[model samples]
Target chain A: MPAIEVRNLVKRFGSIVAVNGISLEIEYGEIFALLGPNGAGKTTTISILATLLKPTSGEAKINGYDVVKEAAKVRQSIGIVFQDPSLDDRLTARENLDIHGRLYHMSREERQRRIEEVLEMVELLDRADSIVKTFSGGMRRRLEIARGLMHKPKVLFLDEPTLGLDPQTRRHIWEYVEKLRDEGVTVLLTTHYMEEADYLADRIAIIDAGKIVAEGSPSELKDSVGGDIIKIKCSDAENMLKKLVSNGYDAMLVDDEIVIKAKEAEKMIPKIFAIADEEIKSITYKEPSLEDVFIHYTGKVFRDEEVDEIEASKMKWRMRR
Target chain B: MEDEKMISDIYAIYLREILRLWRQKVRLVTMIMMPLLWLGVIGNAFNSVMNLPTQGDFLSFLTPGILVMTMVFTATISGITTVFDREFGFLKEMLVTPIKRESILIGKMLGGVTQAVLQGILILILAIFMGVKFSGAMSIPGMFLTMFLVSIAFVSLGLAVASKITSMEGFQMVMNFMIQPMIFLSGAFYPTTFLPDWLKIMVKINPLTYGVDAMRYFAIGVNEFNIIADLLILLIFSITMILIGGHFFRKS
Candidate 1:
């Protein structure tokens, strides 16, 4: 049996179905990614597996123990890094680790030993005594990961590990996660970043509207959608879109660029250029991306970049008294 | 299989919970000291300023009220920390840990309970120095037991409120709406004997009234209600809230 097996798991929060009867198995030691847009049930599904939320129906098991029935056992088996940072800024890292250790009934010596090991793993050994508030976003995320690893979990679930980070900080995190992959720990990660999912995950499930739209390896999902991507950039994209489709070619206007998906992009590109009498600016054939695959399945962008600016600004509100 | 420890398990978390209040030591100092002031400043302020009818003196009558109130505010305002933790994601971290979920509840409740007792007792000691007389006062052990039950009831109330709140804003809103009204309604500062007949019936239902009345009843031989009934009601409320609060808390 696989390390993590979710069978027809459905978690509904009132009227909204967060995990709409989705099911998949995460093999032991494999870095599997659940790729989805926000509110697509990725986090909800992860929460169920982590035993944070009980399913409305169906069952999920980790190492053969039911997540709902054997929650303590499931909790013992999995380490989860929630989307939010889960560290006390006032407390030193070592102290945080110690408390968690005590809760799990770890002896003083064993807890101390593991604390040192995890701190070193995240390369925060030097800063272990410092309060978490002093650490940067990337460092705090690393500590969150370290904290999750305090117990050697069978699977580590990271929900959008690099969602709100700079590219450089994100890359640093990517390398750290890669190190975990090498250590033979089965990693189940949810990510909005196409490249992050494609680069790290061995197998990927594309979920949308609380359901799995597609499931395969990175290359497989892209290839399953389009054999090759024929790229074309022109000033009159709308006109170009009309002419290409009128010529019976399956061409999609992706934001500013025109993507023509076909068996052979080399064969399709010349025909596309010949058909369009608009501003022929630039044309280059290229490989497909997870973004393209997502757009192929769902008409909208992978992440609605049009997130409400006001809702995003509320994180800085003075903590309630 | 042997290497799995929980998230950020630290000894300092308990210390940190203490220190979080310690940095704002004014609240801790004020929680206890304010009650002590009632024994001295307020106790004497009324001693000369106005004459209040009681069996012994106003200080003895007021002391138990202040002490129970001390515990009440200590437990009720503790919803603030719960709100703060929700904002900072500290509470969420504790919830998902593999260890017993009850530890998070226990650690937090114990801290609030400790703060309330130490603060209330500090004021009680101040009352002792102020020469406030105690007629029916039990031994030191009996006094400690009374404080424990009262403090536990208060802490349980705070836990109950903390568990349902999602955001700090919601927690604070509820705390302000529920906790303050509870404090004023519980006879923390005034005697319920002065209350109207209908209001007195509500006060009879209010656990704080029983706690304050009973605690004073023990300390200085005041009030007419059975002390055993008061203690039993408060104990039931404490246990019921702890179970309900702890249940919702683990899920949240």
Candidate 2:
């Protein structure tokens, strides 16, 4: 059995279907990423699988235990670092991890040993005695990650692990996440950063508007955009797009530039110049990126707006409380 | 084994609250000072206007009420910590743990109760220092028992209200609207006998009325209702409030 199995999971909050029929299977020791813009249902899917929210339909299992029926067993096997800061800032780093250990029923000696190990793993042993309120944002994130690993869970879910961090801190967190895979731990993370997914994920599922638009390895997803992307800025771009389409080239007019998807763009460029009657201002071609892959599947550019629709929905949920 | 784990989980949550309380130095000073002010200022200020049907002084009559007031105030506002936890995201960390959700609620309620009872004891000591008389050494256990019952009931009620209130401002508004009426109507300031019948009905319905009356019986050798009846009503109130609070907490 897969380490994590989600079968057509659907979670609805009244009229809003937050998670719309999602399915996934993750094997042991692999780092998987759910790449999406905010409100793309990545966090909702993770919440369902972590047994924090009940699904409207379908099912999920962690370590072969049903998320709803065997939720206790599932909880025992999984650790989660939520998108928002969840540590009690008043407590010291060691205290926070100690609380997590006690919650998981670790013995006193085992908790002491594991606390040192996890804190050292996150390079926070020197700051273990310092109160979390005094730590910087990056340090807090690292401590939260350490606390999540306190119980030695089989699967760790990191929801926006390095969100709101500097480039150096983000890289440091990525390295720690990569280290988890070497320890034979399965990791499922969600992020909007294309490079984050590209650099760390063994496989990725590009989700949008509560649906998975595409899924593959980073290179495979880039390759799925069909080979190379060729953009030509030219006079009479409309005429150039018409000429390329009539000549059976896969082309589209984007912002006064003609974009073409061709395998061997260098060879296709000579043919394009031969066919085009319009004056070409400039021409550029490069291999497809994950951005290109996202645009290819969704037909829209990725917007990095800070307004999180999931947080808005959560506010509504809290209001209903 | 499951039961053992649940106990340890509850202990962890309970320990965190204790640690947080210890860290709030200002709150400790206020806890000690507030009772002194109430017993020293209000106990004397009200003595002139207040007349009791019993032989004891007004200060002695007011001591038990003040004790109950300490417990009620501390326990009820203790739920504000829950609202703060929710706002700051720490509650989510606790909720996702492997332990049963009810363990979290129980742990928090017990934590609030511990704080309340400790405050009540501090007030009791202050009341004695202010020349308030008690029945004897044996009354100490009954007084502690009454304080515990009052603490548990109000803490559960506070948490129940908190489970539905998402914001600290909203909770403060509701608590302000609820707490003062519960305190004033419970005969914490004056005797319930001289009040008009309609006002007496409100006093009869207040849970703190029984708790204060029971404590009064132990502290001042005075009895408004049967001690057995008072204890029974407080017991029933505590259990009912706990169930209601636990239900709301689990739902959230």
Candidate 3:
């Protein structure tokens, strides 16, 4: 059996069908990423698989245990790091891990030993005795990750693990996640960061509006869009687009820039200047990224959800905790 | 072995609440300070102006009433923490664990009862300094027993209300509207015998009235209602409230 299997899962919140008939299978010892923008149902799907929310229809299994029927076994097999911080602010880092260990019914000696190991794995041994309220945003997030690993779960779920963090901290979290995968732990993570999926995930699924638009390895997904992207910054982009298309070239205009797809962009670059004359100011060509693939499948740029002031403050409050 | 671990899980939740109460200075200070002001200012104001029922001073007669009121207030505050946990997402962490659901509510209810009883005892000790004696009508253990039962009932009552609300502000509004009327109808500040017929009927319907009546009998050897009947009423109220609270907690 696959390590994790989700078959036609559907979750509806009144009139809103957050997750609609999505299916996925993740093999053992694989680091899988569900890549999508906010409100794409990645979190909702993970919640159903983790047994935090029951599906309205269909089924999911973690380590061969049914998520809804054998929820206790599923809960015992999987660990989760939620999008929001879940650490108790008043407790020290060690105490928080200790409580989690107790809940999982780890013996006293094993609890003590595993707590130290997980703390060191997150590089938080020095601050283990301090209360969580005194830690920085990055430190608290690392501590939450450490707490989630205290139970030694077979499968781990990370929902937006490095959201709202600096570049250095995001890189730091990526190393620990890679280390977990190296130790043969199956990890399922959700994120919108294109570079993160490219750098870490062994397999990627691009989801939009509660459905998977495409699923493959990073290079495979990018290769699906076909050919290098050549973007020219010039005046009269609309006129240039029409000229290139009439000449049997796939070209389009995007925000004052003319873009074209070609198998050999090097040879195409000189031919493009012949049509432009003096209208071209600059030109650049690069391989298509996962972002381009997303646009290719959806026919639209990724539109980020707007965060209201109350939601922003709630995030700030959690970071403080 | 599984049973032992389950007990430890409950202990972890209980200790978490205790640590929170210790770190939160404002909650502890208010829990201690509220009863003192009530016993000092309100107890003194009624002493010289009003007639009393007990054989001693008005302060002595008012001590048990103050203890019961403190328990009720502290129990309500205890339940509000559940709403806070839900609002902040900490409750979700606890819910996703492998432990049983009933243990979560039981652990929380026990923590609330412990805090409420501790606050009630603190006031009882303070009352001794104001010349109220514990040996008046019941043994020291008897007074504590009555306090424990009343504390459990109120904590469960608070949990029942907390389970229905989602916000801290909303819980406070509901508590404010519910607590004052319960206090007045319990006859904490006056005797029910001298009241008019309708008011007496209101006191009879209030569950807290039996708790106060029982505590009054234990604290001063005086009975407004039968001792067995009062204790039974409080027992039935506690079980009913816990069932209601547990049902709502499972729904959430």
Candidate 4:
């Protein structure tokens, strides 16, 4: 059996069908990415497979144990790092691991050893006894990741693992994630960051609105849209879209930029740049971003809206224990 | 497999919760205040205003009810912390673990109930100084038994309500809607005999009414309701509330 299997999974919250019917299978010892925007159901799908959620209909299995019937077995095999930070600020990093270890029934000696290993793995050994509340956002996130791994779960789920971190910490987590994969753990994560996915994912499934729009290796997904991407920056892309189509070129208008695919960037550069003329202040060319691919399939990434203050307010709590 | 893990996890989580609350300054204030307010303020204020039958004094008869009511309120509001955890993703963090989901609520219940009951017990002692007398009516052990039963039943009722509400604001609103109503309607502040007929009927449906009635009867020799009937009804109320709380906790 595949290491993880989700078949025709569905989840609903009252009138909101958060996850439509979707299916996926992941092999052992591979790092797979579920790429999507806020409401894409990637987190919902992972939650079901992690045994944290029950599917409205259909089935999910982890290491051959049914998520519904054999949820205990599924949970034993999987570790989840949620989209938000879950560390207890009051506890020291070591204490956090110790508490989780106790939950898994780890012996005193065994848990102590595991704490050292995890702290070292996250490169936080020096700060192991420090309170988590005092730690930086990046450090807290890493501690959460370390705590998730204390049980030695075979399948690991990272839901937006590097979210809300600076690029430096994001890179640091990416390296640790690489180390886990090298150790033969099946790692699954959801990200909107194209570079993060391209740098780490063995295969990526592009999800949107509770459905998989595309699934393949990074190169394969990019290749699916045809050739290397050529972006034409202009004051207005509306007139340019008409110009490119009238000229028999399939160019997609993405905001102020026109993205087109061609066999060779060298030859297509002139024709694409000609459409913009003096209107083009400058032009640069790269292969394609998962963002580009997202735009290729969907309309826009709307990255600005992703970080609105409304999403931040959702994180507030009561006594904050 | 899940059940065993859940039970053990509940124990661990409950222990942690109790430890945290014991360390909290504000929680310490509230737990002590609820009982102190009754013994020092409410009990003293109504010392001679309302004439009620008491074995020794009004404060003595009123102490047990306030103790149980405090436990009931504390236990019910315990879910508010869990709601805070849920809203902040701490509860979700605990739930996603391979451990039993039932353990989450169970741990909260155990810790919350323990604190509440202990608080009530502390108040019971203070009541002695407040002119309330214990005639050694029942053995020390029997008094312990009575306290245990009352605490468990009321605490369970609190957990049942807390688990159903999601937000802290919503939880507080519902607690006000249900708790004060239960308190007045159940004779936590006054005697059930003083209540009219229709209210007396509603009192029968409330676990607190039966719990306080049995508690008062345990302290004094009077019985507005049959002692045997009250004890049996308390057991029923305790079990049913536990089941209901467990259901909503799992739903959560």
Candidate 5:
């Protein structure tokens, strides 16, 4: 049986349909990612699977227990790290983990043993007694992840796990998530970063506007974009796109650049330069990224304006530190 | 087995509140100091100006009222923790757990009750030190009972309000609007009998009126309503508050 299942799950807040007919089936010991931009209902879908919100229609199950009818059982089997920081800042890391264990009905010995194990897993054992409020942002996120793993849940949901963290911390968190897979835990994560999904997810569902636009492995999704992407910075991108399309090349204009997809794109670059020698200023060819895949499926650029602003400030703050 | 898990869950939540309270040394100091100022400074100021129909000295008459006031203040504002938890995102951690929602509500209410009762005891001790008289050693347990009942009722009311309000500022506005009226109308500062008919109706409806009256009977050998009637009304009020608070908390 699948570790997690959702069948056309729908959630509506009055007139606004937050999650519209979403379906997924995640196997045991696999890491799945729901990749989307902000407001694409990634968090809403996770909330439903975590049993925090009831679906407006359809069904969801965790470890064979219905999310609506057998919610307690489902809760017992799943742990979640929410998008926002949820730790009790006044408490120490160990106390936070201990309380989480107690909430799940773990005994004294079990909580003690598990707290050490999870803290060590997150490399926070040395700071177990330190108050969460005193810790940095990355430390707090690690502690929250440790707390989520304290109960040995069958499935773990990580909502934007490394959002706003520095590059080093993001990589560290990614490593921890990767380690969870080896422990035979079914993991479902949501992320707006295409690179994060590409690097970590075994399978990804590209979501936009409350619907899954595409779903597959990272390579599979990228391969579906058809061929290598050649991005051109030219004098007139609009005229260049028209010229390239008239020449029977599959190309489109993205922002200020004209992108063309072709087999053996390196060889086609010279032929493209021959088509519009003066119009093309500079051209670069590379393997199609998940971003290209998103654009291919949704016909829109993948961007999170709010997250980008926050990320930029956080990056600047980290650089200052 | 299920019952054991639920009890453990409640205990865990209760322990978190206790831990948070213990860590906040400044808050603890201020909670005790506020009541001291009211009992020491306000009580003396009121003693020179006001005359009561019953009891010896205004300090003795004011002790029970101040005790109830201390508990009511601490209990009602204790729900601010809930608002902070919601704003800080810790509420999601508790809600996603396997335990029943009622356990979380009960645990929080009990935590608030514990803080209020502890503050009540401290104020009671301070009042005794300040030359206030009581009905003797046996009334201590009865006084505690009165404090407990009053604490539970107001804590539930506070939690009920907190559950509906997502912002701390909104909760503060509502609390300021509601708490002042409840305290003033409960006869905490004066005798309910001397009030006009309309004011008397407000006192009759305020649950803290019975709590303060019962506390007065236990502490100063004073009587307004029957002691049994006081306890009965407080009990009913607590249960009703719990039900209403539970309904709102579960919905939230």
Candidate 6:
């Protein structure tokens, strides 16, 4: 049986439809990723599946338990790591995990054992005694992940688990996620980072405007975008895009850059330069990536430009507090 | 087995709240000291400034008022933890758990009651240093029981208010706006019998008035209103606030 099944799930906030008729299935022990840009309803979808938000219509089942009717069972089977920080900074890491275990009704002995095991699994046992407020961002994220695992949930939901982290820490979190998968824990993760999804997910579902635009394995999605992607930074990108399209090349303009997909992009680049020699200032060709697959399917550039702005405003608000 | 889990779920939330209270040393000190200051400064100021006929020492008469005031403020302020949890996202952590919703709400309310009761005890203890004595029909256990009932009622009111507020600063503003009027109008610093007709009506309407009056009847056995009637009103208010607060918290 699938670990999770979402059937036409819809969530509307007043006049706005945040998640509109979404559907997908995640198999047992599989590392599934929902990749989307900001406001693509990834977090909203995760919230519904985790039984935090009730769906406006349609249904979702977690571990064969209906999210709305058997919400308690769904909550029992799943653990969610929210995109925002949720740790009580005043509490020690161990205290935080202890509270979670107790909430799940684990005995003292069981709580102790599971807390230690998950703490060590996340490599946070060394800092378990210290208060969470004293920890760095990466350490806090690791501790949050450990807290989510303390209940031994069958399915773990990570909503942007490595968001706003440095490259090394992001890679470290990815390793822990891979380890969880090895232990047969079905993980449903959402990310806007194309490469994180490519590296971590067994299957990828690209969502845009609250709907799945594409779904496949990394290699399969990459192959679907043709052979190679040639990205060009030039003067008059609009003119460059028109010229490339008129010359029998499949190309599009994305955020002041021209991108083209061809069978042999390396050979086509020289001929393309022959047509718009002066306008093409810098030309770079690379093999197809999940990003190319996204642009190919969505017909628009996927950018999380609002993330940094939101983070900045949050920082300002915190400083004021 | 499931019943045992439900009990543990409530215990877990209660335990965390106690731990948080223990960790906040400054808050502990402030909650204790504020009431003592109110008792000492206000009791003396009223005694010397206003030579009111009828009582054996204004300090003794004022002790119950200060005790109730402390519980009211502490109880209401305790609800700010909910706002803090909501704003900081810790509430979401608890909400996502598989535990029953009633456990979470009741557990948090019990925790706040515990803290408010502790603050009330400290003030009652301070009454000893002020030369106030407990006597007449009200026993020491009875005073403690009155404080307990009053704490539950005010804390429920705080929780109901806190459930809707989003920010700590906003809650603080609400506390500032609501607390002064509630405390002053409740006859916490003076007898309601001597007040003007309009002010007496306002004091009668304030819920904390019955808490203070009953506490006075308990401490030094002075009765502004019938002790049994005061306790009955407090009981009704506590139940209603719990129902209302639980509804708001569940919706939140």
Where model 4 places Cα greater than 4 Å from the true spot, the runs are: A7-23, A56-59, A88-95, A124-136, A220-227, A234-250, A271-281, A297-321, B1-6, B44-54, B128-132, B185-207, B220-225
Return whichever of 4 and 6 wins on DockQ.
6
For all predictions, the C-alpha RMSD in Å is 4.3, 3.1, 2.3, 3.7, 2.5, 2.1
Clashing pairs in 3: none
Error in Å for residue A265 of model 5: 1.4
TM-score, every prediction: 0.85, 0.93, 0.94, 0.86, 0.95, 0.95
State the lDDT at A13 in candidate 1. Answer: 81
Docking class of 6: high
**Residues A25-46, model 2: lDDT tens digits:** 8999989999999888999999
lDDT of 3 by residue, B1-252 (tens): 777767887888888888888888998899878988988888978887877755467777777888888899898779768877876678988988998888888888889989988898888878877767665465577677778788777777777787887777877787678887888889787878889999989899998898888887888776688888988988888888888888888887
The sequence of per-residue lDDT tens digits that candidate 4 reaches over residues B126-157 is 77777676664563554566667766665666
Q: Which candidate order results from sorting by DockQ in descending order?
A: 2, 6, 5, 3, 4, 1
Candidate 6 lDDT, A28-55, residue by residue in tens: 9999999988888999999999888899
| Per-residue lDDT of candidate 5, residues A71-117 (tens digit) | 89999999999888889989999999999999988889999999999
Correct interface contacts retained, every candidate: 0.56, 0.90, 0.76, 0.46, 0.92, 0.90
Which candidate's lDDT is highest? Answer: 5
- Once model 1 is optimally superposed onto the true structure by TM-score, how far is the C-alpha of residue B79 displaced, in angstroms? 5.0
Error of 4 at B125 (Å): 3.3
Error of 6 at A43 (Å): 0.6
DockQ of the candidate models in sequence: 0.41, 0.88, 0.76, 0.44, 0.84, 0.86
Distance from true location, Cα of B225 in model 6, Å: 1.7
Among these predictions, the greatest DockQ belongs to 2
